[model samples]
Target: MREANHFNERRTAQAAAFLLHRSGGQLPLIKLMKLLYLAERKSLELYGVPITGDKLVSMPNGPVLSKTYDHMNGAAMSEPGGWDSWISDRAEHMVALLDPSMIRTPEQDLLQLSDSDLEMLQSVWIDFGHWDRWQLVKYTHDKLPEWEDPQGSSQAITYEKLFQVFGFGKEQTDALIERISAQAYLAKV
Candidate 1:
């Protein structure tokens, strides 16, 4: 019984971290509850917990599971209560059994980018600022240049030039480049 309680607490903490991470460090009660439900489900599968649907009831002020799940289909709009507050409250309640470090942070590292790479990034950003995922992908396929190895290329572009052109701090630009590289989205100049 003690072990079960401890597991539940850790699961709850992990759920909180997943929710906070996905929501960019904040989430409404509804969204958080839904994430918690999914996290708990994953935990059960992995840990062989005897927890059932009924055992996953929400706190009095928290969202009910059904309503919480339903909210996932709704449009992305701000909930009445602040997202930060809800996450903080739940996090505090579960802190005793939860590890705060379990939460994942957003990617913040920079990847190497050539001058051509920076140009492609800027162009894509400009062209698809308002585009959805499919539209962006389609546009990239139709219009973007193919990436090539910079090793043998004679392109004179440097990080300093990219910084000057993009008007982003060196660190910020590098992080963006790194993210693009990770996604295999960097374009060669």
Candidate 2:
């Protein structure tokens, strides 16, 4: 098994900025979460690495990037991290882009996303961006087999489980994880 990786807050902010940019600089919290999850799912399917190395979990709604959700809802007691610098959550629970140029911040390069990753974000937005939060939740629950109904409890959904759904054998999955882990380290270096 591959060692667990820490969450990359920079990448998480980039993903949020991407969604906000596509949604005219503002999005409801639930919709933002859906878009982030979709992009992460696509990244794993295509590149065998997540855009953000955050924990993925099943919530009552759907699959959530656990830490990113916390960051958005202000449940983490954080301030001016990568995400906070670029995004702001209003009283209505909607997140908006505070500074469009924040996407060009120093953390930009640390996001470590390739052109293909950008493609996934744009394509996912194009295809599913119109859906409301509940619709998106229903869609994810129906389409993503790894999503179990948490039924008010949260459940961690590991990469191994995702790889299984993608029909990857143990050896192939392990190798992919190793490669992704190495690439992530190299990017940080």
Which candidate gets the maximum TM-score versus the true structure? 2
TM-score of each: 0.27, 0.87
Cα RMSD, model 1? 21.6
Tens-digit per-residue lDDT, 135-188, candidate 2: 999988999998999989888888888889999999989888788778778867
- Model-by-model lDDT, in order? 0.33, 0.80
| Residue 112 shift from truth in candidate 2, angstroms | 5.0
Clashing pairs in 1: 110-174, 111-178, 116-189
Q: Compute the lDDT for candidate 1.
A: 0.33
Query: For model 1, what is the error of residue 22's alpha carbon versus the real structure, in angstroms, after optimal superposition?
Result: 2.3
Candidate 1: residue 55 Cα off by (Å)? 3.2
List runs of model 2 lying over 4 Å from the truth.
1-4, 77-81, 101-112, 187-189
